[model samples]
Target: MGEGRLFESIGRALGLPPEAVARFGVDGPAEAAVLVETALRASGFRTDVTLYIDASRARALTSVEVATRVAPLLGEEVLVSPPADDPAVATSWFLITPGGERFRAREASPGNDSDCVEIDRASLRPG
Candidate 1:
């Protein structure tokens, strides 16, 4: 589906007009984070994404499961790293979410602005 349609659905799910959600399409990473958070809340799940950070620098955005919902809208395939994987190296394991969003779950050092944000594994568990 086209990017406009995808955000429209997400916006509808969040009780917002398509125009509102469509705005995020051209927005930055911060908008993507807001999109995920909005979708998770609309799904009737907890919105608290905290308490899952493994390291002081592990930036937990949403859970793997929550992200799964957005994955379909992103594209055909989404790659998520297993929780058991070792901490990330400069060149190491990573997850590629829908829309080509790539990130590592753990990192030895602070990530740059271009790196992907981590998610909590516990967020993937079925309730």
Candidate 2:
């Protein structure tokens, strides 16, 4: 999907406003060109999104930094998962919904690794 459409879909799924969704692509055009794999779950849509940040900047980007930037955007009601011992790991944070559903978010991979945030639909229900 096109970047704009992709962000729109994500916003709809997560119940984020347009301005909030725009943060994902704040870096640049290429920043929003994330690899997204979506599935239809019994609750709703679940999406795994891998963001591609600029390699030059990614070298200094830590998982904590990525999480810090993302968590607040998900809103105050969402709970964040604990951090790993190593701050550089791709798996940084898991966003827990009010319904107790979990979704993961991480920093961009240094190599060709396909890591991303797994966003469960805002309407997700506890199973």
Candidate 3:
């Protein structure tokens, strides 16, 4: 799952105010996923993601997204997930790529889904 602390981390890295993020009506953890995606993509990197849906928590016809974390830690890819047991959980992601290909990846997880945002992980971190 996308940890709120991660969002806070992205906020600082992306140079966005947490209040502006808070205004998005992202109350629980689900919305936090979207917020994390938006902030990361807006930071100007090609991002990609895969979303998993539990179907039980979705209120409307929601799409999939990436459950975000530090992803892959040392690779170009990262995996994101939240506990399936969490009620306000997010299981999908809006993947962003340098080529503008925003779609889901053909993968499934009963947990935090996967990365919906792609950063130059190789450039951003060490192996």
Candidate 4:
């Protein structure tokens, strides 16, 4: 799915239209955090959401986040599984950067549970 479509889908699930999503206030990181927190909760995530502004990738201040309800593993030595939600409709995690850029997280390797490579920006495509 395209970015617009992805967020539109998410917006629908969130009962937030495109205008509402944009109205979450995106002028700064504080605003971004509010936007993200609201989205995650509406998506049925009960775990803590952590946000990070990563400039290490492609020299851009990307809003990298991890939904503990989704990708909970913190070490390569542990094995994990996705929550009991359909990945087809509900995304495991979300990435939103400046410029209203958004992406859905996908596993780098489907069966490989180990490593920090599980969820990667490189794994993100249009959606």
Candidate 5:
């Protein structure tokens, strides 16, 4: 799928508005997308979504910036991880809802050999 469409699909899964998702690709396109499902927490289980954007063409915004900007729209408290100095390493960041739903974001290239857990598109829908 095209980058725009991919972002839109991700936005819907995250329950984000189209405008908010558009900000992700303002400077560059997202090269890859992945959705992961982990064991249920004490609160509940939420699908974790990650997208890799071309850093060279994207803005240097931090995870805090992105989470804070999107939190208000979702009416939830979003937390972020500490920044990483190296670009080659995965800087983990998470968006957690009041209900304990967690969303993680990471920076990586599409060609990276890291194994990503894949799920069908239908799984993106809210359960």
Candidate 6:
């Protein structure tokens, strides 16, 4: 490959597209995350994602199962209810914070920014 062509290929591999990325807030971050996940997959970059969750068993059949079921199809590592002290994971999970009308719904059951759980995968407990 020509040196110039090699550089262009590298840029593409590294995700330097001309189109600016879109950002969403905490609300409906799922949809945005899905987009980012798609881009990452297209670019061949493996990623691990986390989400904010609670200890309530009641929520198990709800988002918990829903997100887990969604991950394999999307090909992502997902976690829920991460540590509040870790800023890296804390920031990682908020892939999209939907705004306007979407943000309105997010406010109702706000996902904790501090928690570091995976958004679309289930946690496997060790015996």
Number of the top-ranking candidate, with TM-score as the measure:
5
Shift in Å, residue 23, candidate 6: 4.7
- CA RMSD for every model? 13.1, 11.0, 13.5, 15.6, 12.5, 17.0
Candidate 3 residue 58 C-alpha distance from true site, Å: 28
lDDT of 2 by residue, 1-127 (tens): 2446655544444444433344343353433323233332232123334444334433344433444444344432232444566463344445554343455544333344234333434533332
TM-score against truth, every candidate: 0.29, 0.30, 0.23, 0.25, 0.34, 0.22
**What does candidate 1's lDDT look like per residue over 1-127, in tens digits?**
4546556544443434544432223353432323332222322121322212222332343445434554556554333443444443333334445664555443333345323333444333221
Model 1 worst lDDT run, 10 consecutive residues: 44-53
Ranked by TM-score, top first: 5, 2, 1, 4, 3, 6
Clashes of each: 0, 0, 19, 0, 0, 19
Q: Give the Å shift of residue 13 in candidate 4.
A: 0.5
Q: Give the winner by lDDT: 3 or 6.
A: 3
lDDT of 3 by residue, 16-101 (tens): 44432331333634443223232344322234333322344322222212222223222223433333554424633333332333
Give candidate 3's total backbone clashes. 19
* Model 3 regions lying over 4 Å from their true place: 1-3, 26-127
lDDT of 4 by residue, 1-127 (tens): 1334433433343334443333233463342211432222221222232223222321232223222111222211111233345464343545443333445665454454332334555766543
Candidate 5 local distance difference test against the native: 0.42
After superposing candidate 2, which stretches have Cα over 4 Å from the reference? 1-45, 57-59, 76-127
The digit string of per-residue lDDT tens for model 6 on 25-121 reads 3553342211121112221122332323223311234333433443343334333332356454433332221111111011112245322222321
Worst 10 residues of 3 by lDDT: 64-73
CA displacement after TM-score superposition, residue 47 of candidate 5 (Å)? 4.5
